[model samples]
Target: MLNEGLSARSPKPKAKMNRLYPLLLLVAAAMFAYAPFMILAAPYESTMGLIQKIFYFHAPVAMTMFVSAFVCGIASAIFLFGGRLGADRVAMAAAELTSILGLIVLVTGPMWARKAWGVWWQWDARLTSTLVLWLIFQAYLLLRRFGGPGSDRLAAGVALFGMANVPFVYWSVNVWRTVHPTTTVVPSLQPGMRGPFWYCFLAFVLLYVSVLGVRTRLEKRRAELEALYLAVEE
Candidate 1:
């Protein structure tokens, strides 16, 4: 009965998504396909030169990662206080994506820093805080996997902390004297580079939205199956 009612209520929204999912995927694909060329064409920074070009990928994806953390944090908040399982599923998916994107940011960051800062690792404020944020999401995932009963609430709470850290991470460069570049980098971009940077940023966002939709839908089905099993046991 639960499964039947759930299935009945879901088709309309799913159908509407079906109409838009393909288009979203297509646009993201088109942007990603041409991103390389745009990055190559942009004028190199006077200082960082070829290495600075990585900013096109690194910065935009970092922006997307931060947004994903917020999505997870907000969804987790709703789930924790509202007792909504759908929000929990979204939080889970967002947590997963955040971790994935964080890896990219962390990796590309050191790549750029290696050339710019002459070091692959730094214990500075920005880097450490970013690592902490990534670890928080990873811990959330681990909790969801191994945390027996009532883990969702606990994971949601943890996700909230990760969300709280994002602003600190973003501002750490300026708040303290860190070797990391300041936030001014984006706003100060040269016109030649600004176009590609924004192009890549939009692409990452569309890609995030597309993936989040698919992951959230899958999580819903998995939740349904779990519910059905519980019903059988009862």
Candidate 2:
């Protein structure tokens, strides 16, 4: 009777989840389509012309990377101190998202910089600090994989340290004389450019939410399998 009851209850949740994936895919597809059209449709900059268009997607992706890192750091702190199973899964999901988004930022930034700055790369304050921030969370993932039994706690500590860098990346221009643009410049974007920038920001954020949901679900399943394995061993 208990086995029958468990089977009946389990399918209800699965049925509900089965309905979600198609909707997520549709939203992600729409966002992907919207991005390029908006980029091309936006008015050209008086100075940079075609090259300035990269800013629409590039800045928003960096912003998404920041959001992912912030989520990872917060979830890691909760898992370490609160010891909640849900928090641990969330931390793992957010870390994966951070690494993916950071890669996008790294790639797109260099592409944009090559045209704007006349070089492929520069070790300016903002750029260097942002790169370090990416490396720190990446190290967190590596430590979790190889650090063995108690590595989750160590990774959590690394995430907390990584969180500290977010501010430095944001204010690096004001803190030092650097070639990177400061936050102040954002407010002054011309209306034609601002419209596409904001639209791309909205699209990227929706994409982030859809991807994060799928990743968290996978992490939760992996945790459950590990728990089942340990139980069977015992």
Best by lDDT: 1
Full-model lDDT for every candidate:
0.84, 0.75
Tens digits of lDDT, candidate 1, 19-130: 6777998999999999999999998788777889888998888889888999999999999999998899899999999999999989988888787777897555656666
User: How much is 204 displaced in model 2, in angstroms?
Assistant: 1.3
Q: TM-scores, in order shown?
A: 0.87, 0.83
Clashing pairs in 1: none
Model 1: residue 220 alpha-carbon error in angstroms: 0.5
Q: Alpha carbon lDDT of residue 192, candidate 1? A: 97
Model 2 residue runs over 4 Å out of place are: 1-22, 168-174, 178-188
Give a tens-digit lDDT track for model 2, residues 77-100. 898899876677778888888888
How big is the positional error of residue 30 in model 1, measured in Å on the Cα after superposition? 1.0
